[model samples]
Target: MASLPPSDEATLTHVQSVLQTRTLSSPIYAFILTPLRITHASRGLIIARLVLAAPHLNASGSLHGGVSATLVDWAGGCAISTWDLRTGTGVSVDINISYLGGAKLGEEIEIEGRADKVGGSLAFTSVGIWKVEDGGRGSAVAVGRHTKFVRGSASKKVEDAVKTAE
Candidate 1:
């Protein structure tokens, strides 16, 4: 994962609040409060309910594949962290992305991700991306799955507690 800047870490609380309003923040039982904002957050979750901004645009005017990939990775990472086995910290072991279509500049693309399973030292997550206007149109622009190794920063048992509490 790319090291997030300070701005990203500072926005975590706000992002968590936003995720709370929409059912988008929680991927299963893991809370995705923020990506960059959470800094060293154990886990995070978010929804792509709208199109990206101009800064994230490509020359073709459509969203760039890099941007899409980054989005998937970010969401996928959050899913893994939320259900992290040992600590909130985890590292990606694998991420495979398949692109099928293009997204218009202003199209609201909805992306969702969650852990398929969290193991003793690894977590598996999958993210689905598609246009939101018609629910699901054309083919999927991209689909990605991330495998990560869990750390002991926060204790794997905490994840279990959170799950049980939910």
Candidate 2:
């Protein structure tokens, strides 16, 4: 397995711990997708880093399209979470991704997400997946945009109704 650098060890450990617990609540994220470290986080922006692994590869041995899409979606959520918007409760209304290149296994990649706009009922976010280079000026592998609808009282009522029905 590819290992993080000494400087990133602590971050890796924390990411593992969070994934382990999140696995109980969100199995797909922990088991199927590779774990990632949040390198930077602030209001409206979040940056994540990961080393591509076997599970993230396609038949051609490059990063899979689906995996890239998932990362973009997750990154957007992370960006929104940085701002603590909508209590971090929102549903993706639409997501579009454009794949430009691919990263090989064991290669490190950076995912940067930015919340472009956050409205009362809607939020718009963009994400860029980059293949990290020597100078850390990585080339873009993919770019994506996501639109989310902030959960409101109507969403709560729907959840309540579902629970009552169940």
Candidate 3:
């Protein structure tokens, strides 16, 4: 299996620590029940695990569509962060989700996010959520694409300065 380099691993660890210790600023994440266990992290990619629970379910006792969208938003940001290890991942410009299947309570799901392109002013990402069965990834729960406006992010500014200097 592919693994994160030491530096990226440290970044992932720090992010996980922040999630565990801090009261999440995003109310949606708190409502969804936070602290997603990051299974893997590397440049432009992140994989995390979340267990479906009461808050994550709809009245019919399946994973909520809103929750799936929220995961797309959240995971996309994490993938963007991997580009430069920036805490601020930027603001969502657009998000599109396709509900492919359902996951039940007590079921574990894996969310994979990929930063398809990270430019100075914008970042594009895709997220896939799947139910885990028999210790492997099972049916797809949802797939989404997220776009973010990242102009003036700290890392971008620094990079811009370096380019100017060069």
Highest lDDT: give the candidate number. 3
lDDT of 1 by residue, 26-129 (tens): 45322222222222323344344545566556798876777777666666755554542332535668888888777775666667665677777777788877
Each candidate's lDDT (Cα)? 0.56, 0.70, 0.80
Winning model by TM-score: 3
State the number of backbone clashes in model 1: 11
List model 2 lDDT by residue over 25-107, tens digit each.
67667754446877765566767788899998999999899889888877776566544422242578999999999899999
The TM-score that candidate 1 achieves is 0.60
Ranking of predictions according to TM-score: 3, 2, 1
User: Global lDDT for candidate 1?
Assistant: 0.56
- Which pairs of residues collide in model 3? none
Model 2 deviation from native, Cα RMSD in Å: 7.8
What is the overall TM-score of model 2 with all chains considered together?
0.75
Q: For candidate 3, which ten residues in a row score worst on lDDT?
A: 153-162
| Candidate 3 displacement at residue 3 in angstroms | 9.4
* Cα-based lDDT at residue 134, candidate 2: 92
- lDDT of prediction 3: 0.80
